[model samples]
Target: MVFELRPASSADLCFARELTRETMLRYYIQHDLRWQDEAFDVAWAGRENWLICQGDSVLGFLSLSRDAKALYIRELHVIKTDRCKGAGSWAIEQVFSMAREERRSSLRLTVFKNNPAQVLYQRMGLSVVGEEDCFLRMERMCSAAP
Candidate 1:
């Protein structure tokens, strides 16, 4: 299937918001309700965001931020229909490429302990650098040239 990757815009705010909500519901523990518009505003207000689309349908989204040494994957989600089909991997590779292009030393992401994506991260060479109660912090680093 053909895929399109594009930078997110204000016009996409609504879709992004719904995507986030659906993702949370599917993959996360149920929690109390909150104001969605406000939450979406806070999240999409800054940082770099991208949408993974196929034809007219949005398949997933990802966001990133960079510090001096590492690029952080702030968010990534693939719809249930598209999971395990390489969309998430392609999105992650894009982040890693951006990190390499910027001369950053590493790419990092946090995955919940129960998430199957942990295996994917390991396959991509991201080592578990640390862990919290229910989360794994992973990193992949490229050695700097002399």
Candidate 2:
């Protein structure tokens, strides 16, 4: 489907937060972790937020940041109705492009253990590199674009 990644604005904050929280709440519960709206807001304010939209309809959102070692995907959540419709994969491809443009050697993200998104990350070429109490850190190396 045709979609665009628009830079998320303050107006889109509620949508992003709702979508992410809905998507993550179950995982948080399963992992016995807390879901704090304040923490999410703080993170949203700190990261680069992008809305994945097909025309005027928002299908998902992506929150990204970069460290010295990698382009980190802090959050990626597709709307429930849009799941499995290629939006997630497309968003990931865009992140890969961004990582290359930024000269990062790798793409990195943390997923709650047993979250189904782990399958997609693996399919997109990321490998689990580390594990924490409740998360699996995944990474995929890439050469920067010329």
Candidate 3:
């Protein structure tokens, strides 16, 4: 399936919040991590939020931000029914493109240490750069080829 991303607006706030809450709850629970509903608000406001869609249906969302150093992927969440169908990989590819477009040297994100998504990140060429009590920081350096 072809995946497309559109800028997420205030109108999408609730959908974004709920999608994040649901998708993350499982990981949080399994890892015994704390979650606050208000945390989603930060991504809603400060980042470049995109609704990942397949044609007319909304499949997931991701938030990205860039600084002088690297592009940061703040959040990436897909609907439970849509997991393992390549949506997450497609979104990460878009972030890689964004990093290249912005002239950033690398893409960075933090994932729960125990979340299986870490495997996907590694497969996409992101390597673990650091470790926190609950999270693993990953980075993928942009290649010069393109």
Candidate 4:
């Protein structure tokens, strides 16, 4: 299926916020971490948020930020209904493309070790560069070819 992305606006906040909380709450609990209710809003203020769309349907959202070394993927959550349909892969590709355009050297993100999505990140060429208590930091150096 063809996928597209539009920059998320304040009007999209409710959908994106709930999507993130519902999808990520379990990982926080499983790891004994606090799930801050204001996390999404705080992140939205500083990141580039995008709504994943298949035609008119909003499938999910991803938030990206940049550090001196890499473009960081702060959050990525796809609706349960669209989980296996390549939306996540496409979203990663979007970040890669942005990294290329922005002349960023790498893509970085942190994922819970138990989160199955880490497998997808590795598949997309990101490797674990470091580890925190319960999260694995992953990175993929930018390349001319994806």
Candidate 5:
């Protein structure tokens, strides 16, 4: 399916919050992790937040930030119904392109160790760079643009 990333606005805050809460709750529950509602926030106004869209429908959203060293993926969430339909992969590819355009040497993210998405990251050529009690830090070296 065709998907695009659009900058998320204040108008999209509620949808982003609800989508994140729901998806994260399921993820936490399945992994036997604690869910703290107080700690949950979509940060919709963040400059790097983007809504994953197909036409008028908002399928999911991702939040990314960059420094001179690397592009970091702060969050990536696709509604449960939309998972496995290619939206997540599409979004990551867009981020990869963005990192290359910015001349970032690498893309980095932390994924819950038990989250199945870690497998997807591996498939995308990211390697484990470090690990925390609950998360695995992964990085992919971005090739220079041709």
Candidate 6:
């Protein structure tokens, strides 16, 4: 199925909340702190949060933080059923494309070391830069390929 993303609006709050929590639990159930409520709040309030819509359902979403020099993927959640189907990769590519267009020098994000998504991140050209607690901090250096 073709996935398209659009700006998330207030109307999507209910599904967005449930989708965020469900996706988080599918991957982060072992984490110590409960992040669903906090995440939902951020998504609802933050201007950088985006929703990926496929038809009428929300496929996944991402929250980002950006600065003059870099872009950070603050949160990324894809529905459990959508796993391994390129939705996350497409979302990530969208992020990278936007960053590149903005001339951001790099992209960074934190992922649970235990999450299988790490492998996908590595495949996408992000390398581990540091680690804090259970999170693996990664960065992708963006330079125009010669």
Top-TM-score candidate index: 2
Candidate 4 error regions (>4 Å): 144-146
lDDT per residue as tens, model 3, 1-146: 99999999988888888888787888888888777767778657888899999999999999888889799999899999998999999999999988888778999999988788999999999999999888999999986336
Clashing pairs in 3: none
Candidate 6 per-residue C-alpha lDDT over 21-41 given as tens digits, one digit per residue, 9 for 90 to 100: 765664555867666576667
Q: Is candidate 2 or candidate 6 better by TM-score?
A: 2
Per-candidate local distance difference test: 0.81, 0.92, 0.89, 0.90, 0.83, 0.80
lDDT of each residue in 1-146, candidate 5, tens digit only: 78989988777767777787786777687778786644545344444789999999889989888888799988899988888999988888889888888889999999888778998888887899999887899999997687
For candidate 2, which ten residues in a row score worst on lDDT? 26-35
Q: Against the true structure, whose lDDT is highest?
A: 2
lDDT of 6: 0.80
Which parts of model 1 are misplaced by more than 4 Å?
26-37, 143-146
Model 5 residue 32 lDDT? 81
**Candidate numbers, best lDDT first, in rank order:** 2, 4, 3, 5, 1, 6
Residue-level lDDT of model 2, residues 1-146, one tens digit each, is 89799999888888988888899999888878899999999999999999999998989999999989799999999999999999999999999989988889999999988898999999999999999998999999989899
Q: Put down candidate 4 lDDT per residue, 1-146, tens digits, no spaces.
A: 99998999988888988998899889888988887768768878888899999999999999999977689999899999999899999999999999987888999999998999999999999999999999999999995444
lDDT of 3: 0.89
My TM-score estimates for the predictions, one after another, are 0.83, 0.97, 0.92, 0.95, 0.88, 0.84
Tens digits of lDDT, candidate 1, 8-126 = 98887788777777776444552333545686678677778999878888898887877889999887888888888888888887788888888889999988777778899998889
Model 4: residue 48 alpha-carbon error in angstroms: 0.7
Q: How many clashes would you count in candidate 4?
A: 0
